[model samples]
Target chain A: MEEVVIQADKLTKKFGDFTAVDAITFQVRKGEIFGFLGANGAGKTTAMRMLCGLSVPTSGEAKVAGFDIYKETESIKKNIGYMSQKFSLYEDLTVVENIRFFGGIYGLTNEQIKNKTQQLIERLGLTSVQKQLVVDLPLGWKQKLSFSIAIIHQPKIVFLDEPTGGVDPLTRRQFWELIYEAAHNGITVFVTTHYMDEAEYCDRLSIMVDGRIKALDTPKNLKAEFEVESMDEVFYKLARQATRAE
Target chain B: MKAVIAENISKQYNGKPAVEKVSFEVDEGEIFGLIGPDGAGKTSIFRILTTLLLPDGGSAQVHHWDVVKDWRAIRNAVGYMPGKFSLYQDLTVEENLHFFATVFNTSIQENYHLIEEIYVQLEPFKNRRAGKLSGGMKQKLALCCALIHKPKVLFLDEPTTGVDPVSRREFWEMLKKLKQQNISIVVSTPYMDEASMCDRIASIQSGSILSIDTPQYLVKNYGNQLFKVKANDRYRLLEVLKSVPSTKSYAFGEYAHISVEKGHQMEASEIRQHLHQNGLTGVEIGDAEVTIEDCFINLLH
Candidate 1:
């Protein structure tokens, strides 16, 4: 059996009178591409923040990368990478400068940062514009570069929150190729997205609604369980069922 | 006569052509869509048509008034909802509506009939600040403001991109009702499924138009025999299907959709049998219909 890279039992989070994530339980296997799906304000961001150790859970037990999230948050931080929905990068910095800055923050040697930056720039076909400011780059290139910078530290798991929110379909397809490569290299990827079609690309996924996981399984299994022909229909069935249950 | 016209409209940013040599028209009372992703010139086109920005090379006319020569007349005769939430967040829901109407030298009461259906939803929250409303509600208020002026033509840029599915459906229903009022509507969206809701769409990519047609016509012209196949081990099944000499395959839904080469004479049963022969079990295969996303993917390839 594959080893579990992330494990949570009765994990919960709350802000004031509202519960953002409620007693969620699941396991993410090593090297798995796990999709985290939810509508706006459905607790996906909160759940991901807890997993990445950016926020402490209100109550529950969880482990990430073989370390307890509550007691070993610093370790968790060291071993995991995170990219938010906005592609948080310095827009005024050049492409190469952005990579160097991220690499520096991660405490890489100057030579190491330079070498990796070169390799990544070449791989992404951004060699020509490495010196150009990020704000001047197109949206697609910025997304790809942000993703590469996130994993530059060689973290065990990378948390991506809606990494391709506004990109074109063609660029999104290429972004998934990079993710597939990361997973193949034994890096676990936890990604959140609203796009149902992109959900089909994951090895497995969990759908959240109103601070709870409404469905969890492979895309194929979820579609079969819902008896829907596409993920969009599956999402609609689940979301409507969730609303009705409430 | 066309309700809207653009003659070689183009815009440049620091010597780079953001909108290059693009021109299109919208007939009166027609629903036209500008389909593309972020930075695909959809917003640029909308801004030029709405008279918010002057194009470098072309002239545009809305409701028989030149976009440049008669800017105020064009603004008064058309409604525009920009991609971003540009409403006054500090104002109450009712205040936003009244302010917009007042800007057009009209009152909310004067145009109550024009916005009755949409305004009714905001009635309960008339006292709430615009910032406090949810994304869907905020969208409705923006639509209400844009229509309060009673414009003959409407321009919406990516209005439903981030909205929830239910809200998106509601918004489109509102658009349909507005279209029935004989308002020529031009909207842009990144969602391909929404293309079917429009009378016609221009599929755009990298600042260029790929195709312009009705959603049904686009699918009808897809020209592929698509099949959905599944088995016990899906990953292995995908690999096996890809290796098939006469098959071009990709994962779609719970199955791998494969397009067989012509003259191969392979039936679904034969494909299933072949899967069984390859040490796979419980293989199921059947013909499948194409979708807008599929058409877009095919076009991209």
Candidate 2:
């Protein structure tokens, strides 16, 4: 049996009179790629915030990386890596400088940071451009570098929020290759994306509708249960049930 | 007759070309799309056509009015919803609509028929501040304001970039309804799947036009025998695919799609045998559905 890195039981968050996340329950196993999916305004962001310890859940219980979300928020932050498409990496910093900066922040020693910087630059084929500013690189390269840097501390889990928006198909696939490599090295991947095709790439998916977990299963099983040929159809069928207009 | 025309339109930023010799035409009442990844010059072309930015080279015309000489006429005759949220965020939904209508020298009542379907949804939130609305609602309000004038041409840039699937579908349906009113819609999106929603699309890259055709024609003309390959071990499968002797093989969703070499009818048994030789078992091979995305990637290659 695989070790469960994340466990949530009846996790709920509320603001004023509105229940943004309504009694959600799920588990993420170690090294597994778990997809958290939902339409906009479906409380995905709120739920993710609660799990990331950025917000306290109004009710219920959850554990992230063996740390209590409420009592051990700082430990949870240390045990997990995070990267969002909207923000990651420093635009003005060179490739090596950014890596070294992140490594230093993650509490790595000089020798460790040096080794990590060299390994990362060589693996990403950034040796030629290591001295160049991050903003000078292409969008694909920037995203890949962001993702690699997020896991520079070798956290047990990484959370990605819409990591591959607006990238070319080839580069998008290459980005997934990096993801697969990370998972192979025993890191849990928790991601949220608007692309249904990307939902298929997950080991297990949970679709949220009206702040509830409407469906959770493997992609093949979800398709079979919904009688659909593709994840897009499965999503359309489920998302149409949303009562909220947005 | 074309509602919009361009010839060798080009633009640059600090000496770096953003759009290079790009040319395309939009027919009256046609829904045309500029499909490409980010930084492909779609917004630059849209800006040039909308007369918001001056092109450095070539020329363009909207409704027979020159983009450079008749900038005021082009601006007044076209409805453009920029890629960003351009509406007055502090204003209420109805106020924003009324403001745009007044600026265009028209009233909401005058073009109520044009945006009645979309406005009805926003009616409930008429008193809500535009900034407080959800992303989908904000997008709807923007569309309503763009169509409030009932212009002959409409320009939407990356309107569905970060939109959810459900909202994206609803947005396209709204565009289809607007098309019935004889609006020549020129929309741009980075999502290749959305290309099919347009009547015709130009797959663009690196500030150049790649191919222009109806979505159906582009997919039908893929001219490749694509097969979906899967196995128990995905990493091993990807490595083995590098030696599959196929024209192209890449990871797509849950499986790797391989387009076999031209004039070669590679049997499933033979491919499975090849994988098994590489110690990859439980391999599955099936026909792959060719989409506009496939065509666009092929064009890039």
Candidate 3:
């Protein structure tokens, strides 16, 4: 049996009187690419933040990579990586400099940071522009490099929130290839995306609507249950149903 | 006559080509889409056509007025809603609408009929700050500001990117209504699903045009038989389907979409029997239609 890398029980988060995440429960298998789907303000970002140790949950219990989210958040932080919707690298820094900065922040030794930066630059085909400013790079390349920097620490799990929000189709596909490569190397991945097609790339996924888990299954099962031909239609059907229920 | 025309249009930023040798024409009353992702030069194209930016190479004419030579005339005849919200944050909804109308030497009451349908939605929020409105409401207000001038052409760039599903549906409906008024539309979007809503679309990638055609024509020429299959162990089922001889498969929801090689027409029963023999149970298979996303994936492959 596969190990459960992430476990949550009735996890809920509320801001003032508004509940962002309400009594949600789910588990992710080790090394699996898990997708978290929801519209804007549907509690996906809130849930991801809680799991990443960036934000505390209002109630319920959760574990990430076998460490309790409530008490072991620091340990959880040390063992996981996070990349937000916007590229989180300094625009004024050179490509190599940005990598070095992130590697240093993760507490790697100078020699280790240097070696990893070289490997990353070559692996991502960024050698030619290694010295160029990040702002000078194309948007696609910037996103790819940001993702590389996010996982540079070799964390057990990496959380990505809308990593390809505004990118084109071709670049988004290439980004997924990089994600799959990481998962193959035994790194668990948790990602959120508004694009339904991107959601289909995950090993398993859960749809959140109105601060609740409406559906949780592999992409194939979710579509079959919804009786839709594509993830977009599945989302449409689920979102409409949620509205009608309200 | 073409409502909008471009001749070898190009744009450069800091000596790097942003849009290179791009040219397209829009017919009167037709909805033309520049379908590409962020930094695919969609915004550059829109800016040039709307007379908001100057092109380094080639010339563009909107309603027979050159973008550079007759900038004033072109600006007066085109309505543009930029990719980013460019309205005043401090201005109220009604105030913003009135300001734009005044800039064009017109009044909200003078051209009220042109924007009546869209403006009514903003009526309730007339006193709300433009920045305080929801994304969908802000979108409507920006559009109203663009149309208050009663322009003959419209240009919208990724107008629904961050908006909700309902708002996106409603926004498209509004565009369809606007199209009926004989105002030519040139819109850009990264979403492939929106391609079908347009009369015609130009598929762009890495600053190049891949294909341009009507959505129906594009789908008809997709040239693949997509099959949807599922079993009790879906994760295992996808692996088995991927290894099947003469099959190109990918997981789509609770089923895997498989396209068998030419001359290989396996039925649903055959697939189910194969799954059963492979230690999989409760297998289900059925025919599936191609979607815009599917076609886009095929093109990428």
Candidate 4:
């Protein structure tokens, strides 16, 4: 049986009069690609921040990678790796330098960081331009490098927030391979994206509408339940039901 | 007459290529799309055609006005909504609309019919600060400002990039209504799925035109045995599919889209048996319809 990796019970967040995430509950299994989807300002971001332990929830019980969100935020932060729309790499630094910097921040010793950096440079075929500045690389290579650097320390779960936006097809294809590799290596992948086709890639998905989990199931089951041919149609049908105004 | 025409258009910045010898035509009163990912020169093409940027080489015409020589005429005859929200953030929504109308020497009431449907959604928030408006409202307001001048051609650059799905649909609906008024549309988007919504599209990559045809034609001519295959073990399935001779596959949503090469005749059941033989279980296979994304992915090769 697959172990439950992420469990949230009535996870809620409130900002004064606004309930951004209202009594939402869901569970993600180990090594599964769980997609969290919603329209902009539909509380998906708020919910993700809480799960990442970056924001305090107003009221709820949650555990990420077996760590409590409220009492063990530091552990949660340490156990999970994150990447988002705003890239976390330093553009001015070389590929090797960025890897070393991230490794150092993750508390790896000098020998461990050196070995990991060497392995990454070799594994991703970046040996030729490992010393080149990140900004000089093409967008696709830069994104691939960013994702590799994101999981360099091998966190229990990796969170990707719209990682493929604006990337070309070939690069997106390569990126997903890396995701599959990471998931295959026993890391849970929690992601959010606007691309409907991307939503279909997830093992299961939870569509949020007006701060609630309107639909949560595997892509196949969701399509079957919604009687839709594609994730785009399913999302359209659900997003149109939004009664919240931001 | 063609709404837009370009011949060997090229642009460069500081010794770097932005758009190469790219060319396409848009029919009058048609929804034409320039589809590509970010930095693929969609904006550069739009900027050059809109007379906002001077192309380093080649020539283009919009509404019979030379983009270079008849810059003023081109500007006067086109309504442009830049990818970014370029509006007065401090002013109320109504003030912004009024300002754009005055710049074109027109009044809101004069061209009221052109933007009435989109404007009604923004009416309640007319007094709100443009900067403070939600993304969907801000998008609608930008469209309103662009149409206030009643231009002959509308140029939109990635107008729906970050907007939510619901609002994106609404925006497209608005565009369809505007089309009824016989205004030519030249819009760009990073989303390949949106390509099908346009009457025609030009799939672009690496500063070059990959293909230009109606989405239907592009997919219809995909010319292959396309199948969407899913299994409990996706990683293994992908590995097996890649090793199969003459098989091309890419991850599409929840499943893998695979197509075989010519003369390599096969069926879905054959592919199904192949997967079963390879030890991947819970197999599901179906004939998948070709989509703009599949065509774009193929073009990228």
TM-score for each predicted model, relative to the true structure:
0.88, 0.96, 0.82, 0.93
Candidate 2 lDDT over B1-301, as tens digits, reads 7999999999999999999998889999999998877778888999999998999999999988999999999888999999899999999999999999999999999999988888888898899999988878899899999988889999999887678898899899989988888889999887777788899998888899988899999989888888889998887888788887756787887788887767777877777888999999878898899988777777766
Model-by-model DockQ, in order: 0.33, 0.67, 0.27, 0.58
lDDT of 4 by residue, A1-246 (tens): 779989999999999988999999899999999999998778887899999999999998999999999999999988889998767899999998999999998888999989998888887889999999988877677778888888988898888987877676667888888988999998999998888877877889999999999999988999999998888888989988888765
Which digits, one per residue and each the tens of the lDDT, describe model 1 over residues A164-191? 8666666776787788778878899999
* Highest-scoring model, lDDT: 2
Residue pairs whose backbone atoms clash in candidate 4: A200-B253, A200-B254, A201-B253
TM-score of 4: 0.93
Tens-digit lDDT track of model 4 for B1-301: 8889998899999999999998888889999998877678888999999999999999999999899999999888899999888999999999999999999999999999988988887888789999988767888899999999999999998888767778888889989988898999999887776778999998888799888899999888988788999898888889888876777888888789997776677788888888989999999999988988888877776
lDDT of 3 at B48: 87
User: Which structure is stronger by DockQ: 2 or 4?
Assistant: 2
Which residue pairs overlap in candidate 1's backbone? none
lDDT of 3 by residue, A1-246 (tens): 889989999999988987889999999998999998876557788899999888889999999988999999999988998998667899999999999999988999999998999899998999999999999887779989999898998888999987876666667767876887788788999998777777777888898888899999988788788887778787777766554111
Candidate No. with top DockQ: 2
Q: Show model 1 residue runs off by greater than 4 Å.
A: A241-246, B109-128, B132-134, B224-251, B255-288
Best to worst by lDDT, what's the order?
2, 4, 1, 3
